[model samples]
Target: MYGVDACPNTEEPPDLPALGTLLVDTSRNNRVGEFRGGAGCYWSLRPMGGGTEWEVEPRHVRLALPIEQLRARTARANARSRGDIL
Candidate 1:
C-alpha cells in the first residue's frame, strides 16, 4: 500500500496522495489493502466473537527496520526502487 506521499523524505508533501484506510480480515494477515479519506488505515483485531476496530495513525506509520534487520530491508527497498517490485 505504498503511495506518493507515503515516502515523505523523497517526495514533496504536496505530492502525497489522499490518505486512505486499510482494512484487514483476521484470517489472512498476509494480504493488505487501502482506502482514501478519513481513517487512512484500519484493521479488525480478534474477530472471533467480536471484532475490535483499529486505525493506523498517519503520523506513526513508517518503513522502519530494527538494527538487526536493517541491512536486509534496506537492500530490499533499494532493489524495489530500481523497479516496481515493491
Candidate 2:
C-alpha cells in the first residue's frame, strides 16, 4: 500500500469560501458573485442581483477586492430598488 505522502492524488483541495461570501470569478471576466457552495471540484456562485448560478473551478476564483465588493453590493441594491430582485 502506498503511504499518504506517496499518493499522487493526495494533494489537498483548495479551501472553500464561506457561504454568501463575495468572490470574483477571474475566469469569467472577473464577474462578482456570492458563494453558494461546491460540488466535486467546482464551486457554485450566484450573481449579486440574484439570477442563475454558475460553476467555476476554484483555481479561477479569488476574493473580491474592496472596490469590487462595493460595486457588486451597490448594483444589487439598485436592482432591488428597481424591483429586479426580491
Candidate 3:
C-alpha cells in the first residue's frame, strides 16, 4: 500500500468550484445561485436571474453544474421576456 486508503470503499471530498461561477447552496434547500465574489472569510451570492445579494460561508455553497446554469439562465430569460424582472 502506497499511503492510499487501501480500503477502496470511501469517496474523496469534491474540490471547491471556481469564483464568479454558478453553485447550489446545500444549506438552503439546494437553492441555486451565482458565486459573485468573496467577502473576507465569506462569499457573496445572488439569485441566478438577479436579486438582492446574500453572503454565505464557504462551507454552505458548492459549484453549480452546467445543466443547472443553463436552466437558471433560461428561467431568467423567460422572466425578462414576460417583464417579470426589470
Candidate 4:
C-alpha cells in the first residue's frame, strides 16, 4: 500500500497488533518486542531497548502485561543510565 508494488499477499495476514505496541512471544521464551509491521506471514518487532529487529508469527505474540511493560521500560531506562544503550 506504499505505492510501491508489493507481492501478491498470501491468504490475508492474521489480525496483528498495531505498530509500536509491546508484545511478547508467548509461544517462545517470553521474548519482548515492539511491533513494527508485517512481512508475509511474519511480523517485525524491535527489542524494547532498541536493538536488532525480529520476526514472529501473529499466533506467537500477545500484548505485554502492565508489569511486563513496566519491567521492560525500567530495564531500558537502567541500561540507558548505565550507558549500555545510547
Question: Which candidate number maximizes lDDT?
Answer: 2
Q: Which residue pairs come into collision in candidate 3?
A: 23-64
lDDT of each: 0.34, 0.88, 0.71, 0.79
**Which regions of candidate 3 fall more than 4 Å away from where they truly are?**
1-19
C-alpha root-mean-square deviation, candidate 3: 9.6
Write candidate 4's Cα lDDT for 8-83 as tens digits. Answer: 4445557877788899987669988888998766789887775888887777778899998988888778878888
- lDDT tens readout by residue for model 1, 1-86: 67844543443222223333232323343222232333223322222112243433343333222441344345546666766333
Model 3 per-residue lDDT at 28: 83
User: Which model is ahead, 2 or 4, in terms of TM-score?
Assistant: 2
lDDT digits (tens) for residues 18-59 of candidate 2: 999999999999999999998766789999987999999788
Separately for all candidates shown, the number of backbone clashes (residues 3 or more apart, or on different chains) is: 5, 0, 1, 0
Question: C-alpha displacement of 32 in model 4, angstroms?
Answer: 1.1
TM-score of each: 0.21, 0.84, 0.68, 0.75
Ranking by TM-score: 2, 4, 3, 1
